[model samples]
Target: MSKKIYSVICGTGKYIPTNIISNEVFLNNHFTDNSGKTFSQSNIEIIEKFEQITTINQRRFADDNLTTSDLGWLAAEDALNSSGIERESLDYIIFAQNFGELRHGNTGVDILPSLAARVKKKLNIVNPNTVAYDLLFGCPGWLQAMIQADYYIKSGEAHNVLVIGADILSRISDPHDRDSMIYADGAGATLLTSQTSNTPTGILTHKTRSDTLEYSEMLFMGDSYLPENGTKKGIYLKMHGRKLYQYALKHVPGAIQDCLNKSGVLLSDIKKVLIHQANGKMDDAILNRLYKLEGDLSVPFDVMPMTISWLGNSSVATIPTLLDLILKNELDGHKIKKGDKIIFASVGAGMNINAMIYQV
Candidate 1:
């Protein structure tokens, strides 16, 4: 009388826009130092360092008119088609996004029904009870959705679940902020369902931690529409880099250890560490602590760096996009294989960290 287990029968799939923006163009034209220093020399250093560290060489961005929803739909289509799960058959869709249009006086949950209805119509589905909703947190939002979907399916409330983690992070980042220079826009989705074995295609073990006291360490607020003044329409995302890194460095390693212990896996058992690409340096530091790698370039030895430079940081979409790239021959030389266990961990606003163990 053991509990029923669920696994991803089909592997992951991804879709990135066709536009490729090189770091050189982004740095030279879009950024300049306070002293008006053009990024000629420093840009090379940044690109070289990124090249030496991760496997990523380039990243994609949606065209000027595309939003997170567009990327979400494309990625979802690829995932559903590749996963062999009919979109119409999906009993639930848990969409996690940190950036999008938020209606005044309403939570994203309120607008989710409409979006779900649209997706159903696009796919020509007729199910009435196939629930859809948005999960908002930050980088950990996607991981949070996965954990919740597991509970729903296991409880017999859902037969099939599509867990999508997406973001248009560039929409929030200060276009002029150098610290936020790497921010990019993208989306990715996954298919999860009930199965009879510990196939390990989906969630193996997941955990979350929050330090509510440090909640305001990072945040976003849109323009005020109040009155006599000319109306300004725009959203702004901010980060306290120093404080965030401090909390992340303090909590993430422990989170990884705890997840590994719970899953009865070891650090060495992980074939590739698909961590959320916040930055080249931050990801490296976390891996250094977790693996006892005594250096700042731990990522060069462990994670995918090329994607970071090429794709910048897609926030919550980072890991899945990287996973997609790896699957699509963008990672080069290294490929995910069956029986391999991959560890994915993410840290973001709300000062939260979530780690999941995935077996391929």
Candidate 2:
């Protein structure tokens, strides 16, 4: 048979918690360092530089009482409802999270199954092979999960696939570290299936690449980084900012060009570029090369403000979160018409990069 096409038929929902943390609020709240002085006072120049360079304004954090799975459940329901893809129609659910219930027996082992059970119980679709385990690889998990689902749908092993990306940044961020401020808690979902009709714009081709050589560039660790004070503190994320930036600026565009070339699509053919909101600098560099923009591509400079300043860095959730925001707000009453080509590119902690080109 000819190759099958996997269409992202509909994206129904996004779930962000009630509580939001703004940059000003976080700075005041976390002002005091381990030393007596506030961070700005102690490291005046560094804080000032970070303020100018970073653009995230705010990010939502799950209540201390809630877990990553809770966020996932809400997002899952929203996605299923939004797509109108009945629970009975879903054959697989893949949950991706770099930070989830760690105190539990296993990290992501139970996360996927438990979330799957929630849908099964509600929709009453109880089948054995219908579910599979969870997977993790830092921020790239969303695209990685989508690529896997594409394979399953193409091979006819499944009909409907729900790939959810969820995370709790507060759990992974060191309260004392300034970098931690960039992270926020949230979830987004995409429904993937085999496209049998011309009306559906399915994923034409998929490719993912990772350079494990710099595996240690970003990571999380156990109590070694902190003392377990009976509080819920566990692992925290670590990153080499400059080094990672160098690698991403060099590699991500190349990966994107490769994907587009394989699909025989030219750069001019692309419409909206839904890039992973890694950072203003990195994203700017990549998008500039792709569109051949002289300076900034003028691609909604307003959107990255919160992404840069407040929300800190939401590894895998950034792309889908941006997608949700764009669909809800920016794409209205203006540009981004139908049949336009859009590209979703991502670069994350695992030193992983994904560049997917799609039509609107």
Please report the candidate that would top lDDT against the real structure.
1
**Highest TM-score, which number?**
2
Q: Assess every candidate by TM-score.
A: 0.81, 0.82
Can you write out model 1's per-residue Cα lDDT over 1-360, one digit (the tens) per residue? 454566553545565667786655545434334343445556667655555554345656667666566677677788888778776788887778775533322223234444434455565667777787778778887778878888887677776887777766555544444444556677777778777563345568888888777565555553322212443435556666667777888889889888988998777768888788876677777888887632222333545333676677777777777777777667766687788888888888787889988887
Residue 200 in candidate 2, Cα distance off native in Å: 8.8
> Which regions of candidate 2 deviate over 4 angstroms?
1-4, 28-48, 102-125, 198-200, 222-234, 292-310, 329-336
How accurate locally, in lDDT, is each candidate? 0.67, 0.65
Clashes of 2: 15
**Clash pairs, model 1 backbone:** 54-305, 54-306, 55-305, 55-306, 56-306, 56-307, 57-306, 59-310
Write model 2 residue lDDT over 165-214, tens digit each, in one string: 88877766666566666677777777776676544366766568888875
**Model 1, global lDDT:** 0.67
In each prediction, how many residue pairs overlap at the backbone (N, C-alpha, C within less than 3 A)? Answer: 8, 15
